[model samples]
Target: MTPKEYLEIVHIINELKDTPRHCVTKNNRIESVAEHSWRIAMMALLLEDTFSDVDIDKVMRMCVIHDLGECFTGDIPVFLKTDDDRRQEAKLLDEFLDTLPEQLSHNMRALYQEMEACQSREAKIFKALDKLEAVIQHNEAPISSWEEHEYDLQRHYAFDVVAFSSWLSELREEILQETEYKIQQEQ
Candidate 1:
């Protein structure tokens, strides 16, 4: 890709840094889509040792790019996101990807498809990390930021997503403990 093409792609992706997500930070600031993506990528990096049988590098790449769809549609919380929201984001993301150089676009398009399918080990791990990261972030945020439904969500969400791997399942259990502790403290 030419420098201009690379820069253009970067320019497009830069929107994610500014896009607000549903989650709030501990400091009471709204979280950005870029921040969430970076944390999930880091989660993949730190868990690489446990996933030696899987392609850690590919998993990390998926973590980073999985939310590129949100750059165009902004972030719709998983709970609030509807089928039409998914369709719109997918369409806009495809349009954005079309602007990239062929190889990069093709590779990311394939990765997104794999992520959606969650059949591959790399895809499964990336998907688990994405879910786990949000749960983890919810624990970090003040209890006051949570909606009534979020109490149940934080406790129960992502258990199924992480169940594909024993290690990830254990991690989800740990988050469940944190959620219980947070709720008890709130009471």
Candidate 2:
């Protein structure tokens, strides 16, 4: 790749560090999109044993690039994204991918597409972990960090995660119970 092209990729990737996760929390300290991606990648690696059939490398790649579009679109919380928002983000992502070297861009696009498809085993597992990680982060945050509406939103996400992966059912239940306890405690 030309030096200018390489620099462009670096510049865009760096933007992820500045993109904050949109989830509400009482802690008032939000995680960057880069941090969230890193955690999701680590979760894929650390949970490899639980999903013996998955390709860990592919899962890791999906985890990292799944939110790369947010660097351009900003982190639009899933609950608030409209069809137009998704189309815009997809367009931005396509443009961003064009800036990379051919093979890398192709591979990244494929991984991102697989994650979006959510049909393959790896995609399903990654999706489940993605939602699970968000709830885990929310649970770890200080009590009352979330607004009243966020509780129901989080529960919806947690239940969806359970539906995606039966292996995560126990963890999903624990997160819901803990979240409920925290809500009650705050009252």
Highest-TM-score candidate: 1
TM-score of each: 0.98, 0.91
Q: lDDT per residue, candidate 1, 68-175, as tens digits?
A: 988789999989999999999999998988888898889999999999998999998998889889989999999899999998899889888888788889989999
Clashes by residue pair, model 1:
none
lDDT of 2 at 153: 64
- The list of candidate 1 runs beyond 4 A from truth reads none
| Clash total of candidate 1 | 0
Residue 159, model 2: lDDT of: 76
User: Residue 144 of model 2: what lDDT?
Assistant: 54
Angstrom error at residue 60, model 1: 0.5
What is every candidate's alpha-carbon RMSD to the true fold?
Answer: 0.8, 1.8
lDDT of 2: 0.81
